[model samples]
Target: MEMLSGAEMVVRALQDEGVEYIFGYPGGAVLHIYDALFQQDTVNHILVRHEQAATHAADGYARSTGKPGVVLVTSGPGATNAITGIATAFMDSIPMVVLSGQVRSDWIGDDAFQETDMVGLSRPIVKHSFMVRDPRQIPEMIKKAFYIANTGRPGPVLVDIPKDHTAPHNTFPYEYPKKVKMRSYAPVTRGHSGQIRKAVDELLKAKRPVLYAGGGVVQGEASQALTALARKLNFPVTNTLMGLGAYPGSDEQFLGMLGMHGTYEANMAMHNADVILVAGARLDDRVTNDARKFCPGAKIIHIDIDPASISKNVAAHIPIVGPVKQVLEEMLTMLDEQGEVGTDTKSLERWWQEIAGWRKVHGLRYETNEQGPMKPQQVVQALYKATKGEAYVTSDVGQHQMFAAQHYLYDRPRQWINSGGLGTMGFGLPAAMGVQFAHPDAVVACVTGEGSIQMNIQELSTCLQYGLPIKIININNQALGMVRQWQDMQYGGRHSQSYMESLPDFVKLAESYGHVGMLVEKLEDLDGAMEEAFALKDRLVFMDIYVDPTEHVYPMHIADGSMRDMWLSKTERT
Candidate 1:
């Protein structure tokens, strides 16, 4: 046994868990932990401007790498600032462990300086939260936090360490736990044989079949399994906004993303599907506008690790509760046993033809003027071309997020990272920082709107300090793009306060932060600007692209209408 202070135990435990990077912002209450971090070199700490960015950065790291992201912060405001990012992770089910310093145990009720009830504040969002009651329990608690964050349906887990818990005097013999077990928590990893059989039977009988995938496919690392199953059955695959790249976008079987901002072909396929196989996707409002109208005639075979998510939104006719990768693998094995007896070939052919007809709607089409203001969609398309579809793309929530999802045809999982469930605007830039850190040699880009970029713009300093050469693609609509789009459609064209009245000079702002900045107001200058930016391989580059302010994301669905009802372009907004 090795004698160590509580702070030392924290560092040792993280290293044992194979943690290589941590995102954090230091404060008074967490100085001891910071000091412990300083004495170590295995775990690198990324200093962020705000506590919120730390969590978002950690989230990006987790989503991109399929590992639990770690975060360290001070008590009170530090913990509270991280709440939004934690909630964002919770909604998306990202694996993360948040370590926050707290007030001393004796001063907890006294409301001492920098004291805040972090456990209480974070209870609703985290998968589990713990307040360290004993200094010796640090190793065990840290292990449990990581276990909870990464197992079952992966999510953020918080562990609040009172400053006294890590005091220099509280020394003890420490050994990091090799394994963690909780009698109360055991997630089923294999699907019920009977349920999988039933699902296979239903699939063989499907006339109009669709394979709908969500973040779970990416989280479960089952993209290959999903692709194999879809090809075996010849079913059209449609992914959710967060589920992009689960199937190759260029594949003829892929029907594009399916949801509120999804493709017209994908939504139509969902509405008319006879057998819908939903893998790791919650049928949230964005995907299913009204539960009553979603896949009305479909016999849904839902595969999920979380049983609560199966029927919580849309009722599952044949539910297989288990790990998506395992279940999908099992399903493939069963199909393999059947040889060529699996799908109704004639029916699948008819389904594919119907999908092709729907695809002709061309919902993603956007205008590109050689000399006029740029269309935001073209920026994303150009990004895809410049990167040759190899860059790791992250996005902030808004019209640009939708455009990126629609235009940037991803061919692999974990490449398209964004705030999907919580729709957090400030997620993109900080997330790109984490993505860049994870793959230092890979090209990473943050696709964000003007409003979203400013939310965590201060992280520019962190980028400079770390030498993270991420490309920041700012689609400057000079207004809250999404808000204006909604107002224009639902509020009788009332712009209201959606437009930005006072905006900072983004070009100078980037230059001031010790990075290269380029402004592209016309289509001709766009390609040249992007080329120059990527050519600077050692420095971060910010491209401020001014686009038409009145443009709205189209293929817009009718309010309170089923997936079948969609307005292909602005001509049908009314």
Candidate 2:
């Protein structure tokens, strides 16, 4: 039997990895990979309008399915186009494999046609990157890429293949690489018993303690373990945005999301805690607000899969490098052995009462006139009510994204998909399409601002063509919401053309794509509109919501401010 080329070997390896779908756009340098796709029958390809959209879609697919998202694009512009998506996935810690074709090996570094050093370009954004100089190495590179992407802390990986390597008549047979060869890639398991003992000792000693959960909890699927740990220790668990669904929102110990836009109580808990058990999350700039002042009295113990993340942003007194799930499980076992795993129902009851008091004082809710334009919060909350909080939600960048983050009770971790790292505009629509495609049984919603919607409104056709049922709720404020808000607050309220004069009627736009379009004016109609959208089968529905321009996401941690420095209301004293 004849051996396949490098390009063919990649496709075969991806098939073996159980990749059923791919997102990409073809170009000259990557034509060989596309050609190989034609000869294969396992993986289906989705040709997006742009390479950026392709990578975002792949990200959505991976987030929804918990599988490696595969994307293929040509070299040069194609590779560059994927930068934003890669960065978005990187920040959010998503598993994705991006494949780009390169110039022939002979034409290296001579300003070859449509050639760029993709491996170098993608280094900062990907977990690992590989450039295949030999055809025989293609399989091994792909295997390694997938392994790196899905294991421990998930992230995007890039594989660049030279054009010459894809041609037949190469000496090597098609055998995929079995394992990655990185000495530093080994993830720490649940073996740090001394650290666990120290964490437990500190937990018992501290009067005010909190469990600071981050995205790592979700990535490690350690929700159960985290819940057990918190329950046994009688500590409230406050999550960062990436760790939203670490524990059920209904749980007594689950404090709402913490960060710049996190709940007031969550931030307050962080500030007041005497000890913090940091698990599976990177305490980014937003979360720390003021790192020096953050948890001023708290002794912090950090547990993460990646060692660099331990001391990169926030200082940790006790750093436990291990898979989050493994670490939590080991801690739970040790607690059980020490006869300290049983919950104190009375103490937990008191903790719940305290949390309830905070909720009464700070939980998100609002009142708006039913006769006028809708409030963004009202629209989002109504969607939450209409869907019974079961639908997967994606958001474009801006005030609308913040609104969703504040109001929506995301039941699952990956269910809340947004461009957090990149804050990329026009991410919701395409990402929602990808999410719905991957999970056809679940209804998906894209909450986007008017300006952000127009960034990729072209994808409406993609939604229609694929018969994807996506509810696109456009919070049409007729301005770049974030910039306009900044102008109103920081700049002299001059507006400075931040607001657009003419905006297209999104209902008509949806109709042009052979889809249903609904106009929402009054708050009373919001629930009805969502119900109608949910009832539709294989149809794209655009809900044009006229939201108030003055409505800003409250408790906002202004840019570069500490999470504690949040404004509770327009008139509240910061």
Candidate 3:
């Protein structure tokens, strides 16, 4: 082992792990490490506009590439600002490693300048955290962090290195562990073979079956396996919002996204199915308004990597706790061995016919398209057409997110990235940047609402600095669309604190940031604007679309109601 300074060891350890990007910002506590990074060539550090954006960029990188996203931040506010991003990743189960610089070890408890208890502050959101007291612990701690972050039920991990540890006066022997094994934390990888057979038995016996999935299928890289199994059984599939791209959205068997603001057919199928084969999804409150009343007739077969997730909210008759990809692949193998399905095929045919009727009752069809302001639903479709359904699309939360999920048909995994659980606003721009960084030649777009986009609009400078040409689709409804819809439904139309007055001109704002900008107000101009924005391959284009302010997301779930019960349109609201 060669002697190296603590800062050098930090950089070297990252290089050893094959980390290509480090999303972070610089400060006094991390100066030495930044200096060491400046002297390196293999690992590139991306300077983000805010510490929160750094964590989100890393999240996007991890979600798209299947590698643990790395982050570096100073103490105090640097670490605290990243809590939302960390929580977002935690709630969604994205793999990430966050390296934070701390105050001197001797001054830690004395509350030195720029010092805060990062470990305690982030403990609730992170999968695990470490405080480095010795310079010798750097390499191994990093190894442990990555290992913990990317394993089963992937989430963010934090490593807090005291400034004293990285002092220039210190030197230590460094070696990254080839492989790490922690006796206390060995996650189960393979499901029980007997359980697989039991699940198969249940699957083959059902006539009306729905293959419901969530983010787990994508995070576990089981999308292909899931697709194969669903096609083999000819079962109708529905995805949660986070699970949008897990199944081919354009396929005939896909019933579209299910739950609140989901498609009519998908929600109906879940409510009416005789059996529900759930994969990689914990039926969250967003999907199941009243867990006690969710799919009472369906026998649930749940597959998850975490045992605790199974039946935590909804009862699972067949709970298989293992990695989703392995479990699905094993199930496919057993199907092959069984040779042929002996169940009544006529029942499935009738089931499909019923689903087809619900499909025709979809909420995506506009009420009136010929007059008045542009529709956000049409904007999402125009974006899909402009990119030929090939762009890496990311979005902030709200009406636009739901619209994107309902209209933009994703044919492959990792194409649709957004904050599903935490519903964090301002995730789109930085996430788009990270996605573009991962696939430089591929088209990238950020579908954002006016309220959500303003949360992190300053990232435009970072985009210019990095030469990332991402299309920004701004759906300007001149109001907090979702908030207004809810307030209107629940509070007798009290528009207090919901209407967004005096919105800035997004076109001028984009130009001020040194990027191309255009305003699309007419329905006829929507497609043309999207096509033009995408044609500017070397420049970032911001398309500010003025959609109908009165439009609200359809198929909204009723309170204390089943999945099939929904407000299909504004007229049906409460």
**What's each prediction's clash count?**
0, 5, 0
Candidate 1 structure quality by residue, lDDT tens digits, 1-574:
8999988999999999999999999988888889999998999999999999999999999999999999999998998999999999999999999999998888998989989999999999999998999989999999999999999999999999988888877689999888888899898878999999899899899999999999999999999999998888888999999899999988999999988888889999999999999999988888887788888899999999999999998899999999999988988889888787657898888888888888887887766667667899989988988899988999999999999999999999999999999999999999999999999999999999899999999999999999999999999998899999999888998999998878888889999999988889888877888888888898899999999888889777787788877777777542
lDDT of 2 by residue, 1-574 (tens): 4478777787788898889889888988877778888987889888788888888888888877788888999889999988888998998898999999898999979989989999999998898999887787788888888988999789999999888888654535766555577787775556477987787777666666779887788778888899888877878888877677677665667778888777877877777676889998888887888676677888988999888888787789988888888888988887788784544456555655666666676735555765666789988888898888878999999989888877888767777888776688978887887797799878899999889888888888878777888989899888888888778777877788789778998899899989899998877777888888878857888999988887766676656555567777765724
TM-score, prediction 2: 0.94
Q: In model 3, what are the clashing residue pairs, if there are any?
A: none
Worst 10 residues of 2 by lDDT: 340-349
Error of 3 at 479 (Å): 0.9
Alpha carbon lDDT of each predicted model: 0.91, 0.81, 0.91
RMSD of 1: 1.1
Q: After superposition, how far is residue 406 of candidate 2 from its true place, in Å?
A: 1.9
lDDT: the better of candidates 2 and 3? 3
Give the Cα error of residue 112 in candidate 3, in Å: 1.0
Q: Report the Cα RMSD per candidate.
A: 1.1, 2.2, 1.1
